[model samples]
Target: MTAKQRVIRVSTEQPTYAVTVLGTEISIDVNGFIPRGATSFDVRGTSGLRVYVIYNPKLVTKPIGAVRWPLNSEVEVIVASNDPSSVVNDNKVRVSYYGPTGETLIANAWLYLTCMAISLDADTSRTGVVESTANNKTKWTWGPHGEGAILLVNCDRDGPSSGNLDNAYPSVRSYEDLQDMSLMILSTQGPAGVFDSHKLLLHISMFDAGKVRVFHVNGNTSLSSYEHVLGSDKLSYAVKRSDGKARHSFFVEGLAFPDADFAGLVSLNATLLEQPSQDLPATPVFTDTVVFRVAPWLMTPNTLKPVEMFVCSIVRGQNTNQKFLEAIKILAKEANCKLTICPEVENRGDRWIQDEMEFGYVEAPHKSFPVVFDSPRNRGLKEFPFKMILGPDFGYVTREPKNGRISSLDSFGNLDISPPVTVKGKEYPLGRILIGSSFPGSGTRRMAKVVRDFLYAQKVQSPVELYSDWLTVGHVDEFLTFVPAPDRKGFRLLLASPLACLKLFKEKQKEGYGGAALFEGLGRVGRITLDEILADEYLRSDSRYVQSCIDWNRNILKRELGLSERDIVDIPQLFTLEHSSATALFPDMVNMLVLGKRLGIPKPFGPIIHGRCCLEEEVCRLLEPLGLTCTFIDDFFSYHVLSGEVHCGTNVCREPFSFHWWNILP
Candidate 1:
């Protein structure tokens, strides 16, 4: 049944995936995932582009052990849009953390943008010379069009001697000579560290024609704010001549890092004249690294950077990129810390990658694109560290799967498919009572709690094993780690992690909703004609759009999937396309569709979620990308979501290398 439409990751779905077509690297989703959203499947230039999906959920109310998907991991999809005709090519396509779950399509996948073929495709031929400025004079120079951002760190190699200041610019030796200084820097944006040489060398310099004063250059006002950057010189000297000076000679002081080496980061500077009187000529300029004394300090990642969720965006100012990086390095004499004084500037927009692209990174000199730090638990570093360091696309790790290994990223190993409670031993696929709430909110916890309550309602007479993903919660992990194995089993209850929500989101985004659809589509081809669930709220942000999805698919699955073989209808193998909890009407009704069946009604997109956008007010909702997996006490079936295990992946403790809860929750 033509179920091969380009699927986009809509929820906490794994947007990043690796494929063999591109050979080891992950082929990002170029075609958009929004169902009925985009008009056409534009797959013309599939040669060299890196694309993927990005799933950002607003709330993480699931517990650990319940799900193991990394909060923001990139999973490779099986199908490649470029080929469009092949499922498994001659070469085996492998991805690090993706498992097959019978259900094939993931829901709400966005077509994330990656690198382009080339920003400035060079022709190689020399272009006509253009009048470019050199030595403050416009001169004809020849070159190509390709220009990359030349990031120079330590260009300032201590200021030149006063004598060297005589000849600056093209032949200038001193740093005190420059016509103009511009910077297009994207820094942490808050309080940044800068190095103003004049103020730094105040104590060492002998002559004080004009004492150096460091300031935070404001991008908006073009003014500098001074809040004690350095130099407790304690005294200053006015120039010998104030208003009526033949010319004042100012020593171009140098700046330095007392600790960090020149390898990682460096410094550079330029020079300007003492208030040039009507009589005084302008100062010479030099374009070289600023060389100051060997004052340095170590900048650990833990320090300098504030401990927070993540960097939203570096606001670009109107007239200066310099405002972002120009910070005065105020090295503390006693300790290793430095108070970076930052000046205010204009707010730039947050740029993002195009559709299906994770951590939006485009190639071009075009101005005004959105950007966010996207260092959630620093997973981006290991997965997608830009091509040069690790190559542009996500590096897919293909491991030889254990023979007959049924577990993919979303599957439970050697799991039982039927529900716990016995309905005359009929063996139902989903559990007895579905304690469900739409979205990954208290829903998971609510499900756990209600499931427990439901079990208790019959006082354990249901005579079945209770399964839920809560076993993976950090709370359970804690006991699983330190507590002896004999003491691990009946651990009572659990507390879920915030990051656990990420796992759930990933499951839905990667395979949950789509997997469910696949179940209804591929299974009971002739018998069951309809499958619908209330999951509109679980959608990342567009809860409303999710509803539309339900309506469209309800009819599609009924008419489409109702034409499978008789084997599927009589004895359906539900290894794929079915979840542990929630509603289970899909398979029950699948029987009616097989004998060329139909569910009477033309549409069945009923039971939409009933919540607003969970991811809209992200900051207020505290949707921080912490490795945090929630933890809580595990009751027979009751549970709670917590904050301790929120930092899920960072913790190296091996208490939780297991996933029994997936069987219950799958």
Candidate 2:
């Protein structure tokens, strides 16, 4: 009756906690306290010891309280109190066992704590593959998202421990883009019953902060696919045996980093570990501090960070341009990493005022008024991809606007605009935009870029000057929305109400917009999602796009709201087909695709074109019906930003296409 067992956790229902411990055949009641099927005990495991481990998409921590064991927990322990009077309080239960000449088995993970002779043993099991159950949560949700659960593991030993000796999976940043994975183990030892008191956690940040997913692998199963991604050179062939009886030693296994720019991956599951209660950090380590492995950066370069700054031009006494020089000096004093405010304006006086309007920067007594953050330190999404340019096919193109010039990017290091100058002798391109002090949203946010590009789309003669001089307002989408390029009257109507032109708003609800609602209201077209606008025959079509749409809706809408698979698949009943969101880029992704069929959707041309250019799928479909075969423009995303140094890549602000691509920045 004195034997140890290691089991794989299948499920944890109270009373009969089913686990195949150590490849042994045995079932135990949770302290034999509760009846079977009465309640369910959630299971979870731990990760590495790092300060940031808690918030990681992969690791987890303490689960269900009572780290050692619940008061009535059906844990079988052997208490050997040599002093006889040792109190066996709620936290003082130890597993009974013999040393040197005999062996003992402790079923409850916390059984070895009350030990006088100590060391409740368990039958060790062969290592199994550990995979993340929460990896799926990392899929793009088109918006912010996250997922997580509680997990628990029982420590079947005494006051001594070592790493998660078992093999585990490496943490993942964006699993979809991961080319390869690695694993690493850590070595540590502490009180035997420490593990049961700790739990595991994992988290995932999806596609550019669009969504977030989380998961917890409880018990033994939680350890898969959560190994340390150590350098390949770190793996060594070694083994250790404990007292000839335990035959197990602790070690750290290192995995590999597949992505180039990503410094490493943090497996929230394998790394969110807590030292058993016997050993706790005086300064609690948070889920975010933990570091694990390196991988190809799925988002931005690990080393890529732009020196954030604000560009401002002071206009004093109605002679604003005079203050431009002083403003540059002020900016240069505050900023580091090399950019100076040296705007190349054909007309100095005009340039001074021009700079002011380049950005959405509106000078006022309140420097912080109606502004996002105080300065560059708090500006920009900090996640824009500017190190490289996204071309028509999502290709990473260097900013080679000039023959040999470099480019300036945002805080996240994504190239924002051509650096306004070019290198003549260097082998690489160094084209970049020269920033003016007067512009607003220059710290890194794209507000200025959005505004400038919108104006430029209007075929503006130096859109920057137009804004600073003419005081033009309203984004291109909002301005030209009701005014078609062919209609002169409509265009004038827009100019009259620069703020929220009649094209974009109604005087009744006239105080600007609610972002998306404004776009839809002025957009004129009905929302595809809100109206269930797709043809019924779409599902019955031969293409799998129909199914793809269903699947997308399920994930984008259903799983987000915890809807059933059936309800999610039934698109008609789920969302408002008329809402503008229904036809956003991702939905357009579904429109071209047919579902259920084994074959994929037969896109007429390349959806690449559909995406590259800001053409919505329904819009693209409309063109075909209208017999207008215009090219798709993938370059839109990259050219979406306001470029003070040059004209916008695509004139989305001016003509027919301006409304569709308004206020967008690459």
Candidate 3:
């Protein structure tokens, strides 16, 4: 019976000695020479033009010198006569084949060559090797022990005469040249039994650095015709079928003034491909991603920013100072910004909904419900109204209990304001708030502890604790605030300097202006001379003690808050005994309000009556170096008479910043 030609893969546990080719069961012997699995080796079809097999050298106990196939067929395989002495180690065994019309054909084994030609024919002869420069016919060489080799197909009926060939195959001209061959094969014949050689190597040469190259490996070919695709718009590529290294080159450059994405975060996406074909679609291997990020510059403080608007509370009869409110309203209108009054309706506002109740809550929501209020009154806690906070993203405000509160402890009245402090070259939110150890373990220190905890959670530096038991109100606003510097990015600490105030008072006295007028309009107190009031021991003692507190806090500010002596701009004013309470006039400027770049100060009734330069002029003069425009409101009856200044009467929600809070958090 004549045998039909077929390609097959074979794997064996022992060294292949001989293989019996037959339509029925064929067999092999470990010792190498017989057919055992069937009664007789009868070839019904021709098999083995190419062979793929698995046989590890380490697994073989003995080598069966040769692999031969005994068959009855017209088809045959004639290997090169001058091949290696021992085919035991050679993974592939290539040979020639003859069709029905006597045409010669050559084929290679799959991963490893086991054996080709199921039946051997007698008329086997050698054909001389022919060299050519045409696309169809090309020169070729073999790897070590014929490990990697290719099958050549000739268009002519009669194959060339065979002879010794060159040492190695020349480098592939370009990646496109190799890709062209693949596309031709895929279009003419489908992928089934075609080119199964695992050792097929396509040597690609990269021409340009930025151009993308795609490759397709062993792909799905279940249908009669098969195709795959992968494409990229930018610089992207995929190498799906490459085991050895290839030559490559890349060139890149950077420009000093190139347009770029100003948005801090950027994302990049890319797709990789392998062995692209012109007719067949490219194969998709994988999708990759890359990310780039840059942090933003620090946010400028409100004092340094242009006014966007003014935020205030409209709680009637609770803390309203009509003159102070009207002045702020006029200033907002002049500045062309919105005046946001809380509660919308009159007398319906929460008492703690005022600006001072919540400090710098500008970021998108960072914490959750049942938040702290930091006030003796619970205003913003219950409703959490949008009008009260101004910004949708709100932070927790600390609240002090009304029933069992410690008498010496001061409320959020002092905790909310934080002077901008610079650290590690970056300015953080609420850089430094002054705390007091005067009421340690009491609500005063408790409030400080809460503020410290909150600030730390927000990744801000902790507060600097100062002695506040000396002050009558035990608050920082009465003595200090931060204001914009003339031509800088930072703020200057506006301090109520008693010494500076004394100097100004003496200068006024020398001009025949008596000190008695400084005590007028001070809430109808009993008659008392300036000398009589100054001689009181309590007044003298309180003045000296408060001055010491200011001095001590000033040093703490310099040390912890990163301030210099030059950064401290003193406001002149003197502490006076007001019947039973103590107060100051000129230095009360520290408690002033900032309306954009303008400074809203209270016209000191005492200083004006005592024949000093107008309080407005004096303040503007003192702050000229720092670039402050002063507006003196007649606040004698509304604010100064009530133990409070402009700040206590009004609150402001400053313009929002450019940076997102989440991006800067630790």
Candidate 4:
């Protein structure tokens, strides 16, 4: 056949194909086969481009004279259509062998094609610039021919702003500043067979202006996922900000610890949303390091912030506990402490107030509890010198901060059953405090490590371990507490003393009110006697164990927190039995509601009364000599019986440290 009569056939699953002969390459598709006179095409290597034929119910060539028939022959495959309006059937291929095999024999050698290859030899180059305004807005415009193409934008300091990629970005800065602002734009080919995307990389690293933010101009809103990257150099986390829109907005303030510095590059990969086959960039474009900074308070964590005393608040229901609330208010005034009344639906509901353990935070920029913020505990903290610190949620918590440098405890810790407590160290400066307490078996040790590491990072101390084995309510405040003294880093540790309570009981018995009269008409059974109450299974069974715990606690406080014997205050309070369980009385005064040096002790209700010379009078006498004042607050709900006290009913937000933690810690 003449060159004009020559026919070539091609078939492949991919949309594009390249045909090469000698040193020339020709782009071909099923719709337009090689022109009648076409012959030579571009070539890169010594050999020509090998073409493979794909057929339905594929055929195997029979070999003759030790040579593969089709392989040894000069054969060409062409997909031809006589009518221009007819649909091109990619599955059909017309074969023509110019060597030993003639046209008729070559045509019957193989089955029709199932797919045809289309050329991918389109030019992929265009021009455009990424512009970022002073107000922190970014926009990119493509050249005239660049349309219908995709651009993946990314901030090196922030993670992937478009879709998931291999390159990691920096932590989201908690505060607003443009210390390390950067953007990289990647382009992909458009449907018009042209490089219709503009690529630009902006190096706008300005400080104190704004942090890096990522946004998408246009792309697959459903398939794209945006990440808000935040964390420290050692640890990092990404929060997906995917809103299923053409644009995804990432703000620095959305991070938990945005003030932390992050050093790294970012990447962007673009994929065009085209027909039969999509055009995608193989790699992401990256940028250099980005700087992030914030206020000192956001940088360092403060635990022992100096306070005139301490801020305190109690929870009360508008419909219930009016008398109890009133009593606490008066006591708060005497102590000169700023007090707030957190409102609840029911005064006695388990979740109404006391267990709002997750409501407050020890540090500023506290995490918001979606549910608790609507409660009364969300009041302002202007009157208090420091903010009330909230303990860990103790459930499903992570060791690293979820968004930024702010660390979080793992959910394995059981706060409801774990008594979390804090103590200021005389050795460390203000805000350089530690929480001393023991974790129950219910809590995981990972929580201890997380808390410690986080506090250490913040230049504060971790919680100390205390004895919680003997009490149903595993809280340090159940047996011990502290009051800041006038002296620097000096505080008084108040401990529960069974010995003192016994001594007072003996003395009261000699005066005739400590025996049957002390228990008559008290507790669940109105006819119970003091002797009977003490001899009950609850108190008798746990007394020995509790005494041992008290001893262990006192020793650890002196060793860990550095409290001297003179600095210790033993509260003379007796334990009783209720519902076959051991519990304490209002005079177990160690659970006193504390505001600075003022103590709000529960009004004594046990049968030991010498007119005004009751447990209240005795508690006052013990506190008076230490220059500490005590006020009586009513616990009409029998808080101790319910596994709580004045302390549990309240939360506090103390003042920030007198100086930034960095100045004192370093």
Worst 10 residues of 4 by lDDT: 115-124
Give, for candidate 2, the lowest lDDT window spanning 10 residues: 362-371
Instruction: Tell me the whole-model lDDT of each prediction, alpha carbons only.
Output: 0.20, 0.21, 0.39, 0.36
TM-score of each: 0.16, 0.20, 0.48, 0.46
Instruction: Tell me the RMSD of model 2 versus the true structure.
Output: 25.2
- List model 1 lDDT by residue over 1-666, tens digit each: 111223433222444321221111333333323333232121212333333323334442222442323322232232333321122122222122222331223333333222100011111111211111112111111123322121111222123322211212122232322111112111110000111111111121222212222222222322222122212242322212111112211222212111111211222222212222445543321111122211111111110112111111223433222321221111111122222212222112221111001111111111111111112122222222121111111111111223423111111110111112223333222222211122323223222222223222321122122222322221112111110111212111111122223333344444434322322222223222113222332422222332232223223322322211210111111111123221212111111100001011001111111232111122112211221111111110000111111111111101111111112211
* Model 2 agreement with the true structure over 519-540: per-residue lDDT tens digits: 1321333333211222323322
lDDT (Cα) of model 3: 0.39
The TM-score obtained by model 1 is 0.16
Model 4, CA-based lDDT: 0.36
Per model, state how many residue pairs clash.
117, 166, 30, 51
| Candidate 3 lDDT by residue in tens digits, 523-551 | 55334334443445775565665566678
Q: Which ten residues in a row have the lowest lDDT in candidate 1?
A: 593-602
Name the lDDT value of residue 584 in candidate 3.
67
**Number of the top-ranking candidate, with TM-score as the measure:** 3
Which residue ranges in model 1 land beyond 4 Å of their true spot?
Answer: 1-372, 377-383, 386-528, 531-666
Q: Worst ten-residue run, lDDT, model 3?
A: 250-259
Q: lDDT, candidate 4, residue 611? A: 52
**Model 4 TM:** 0.46
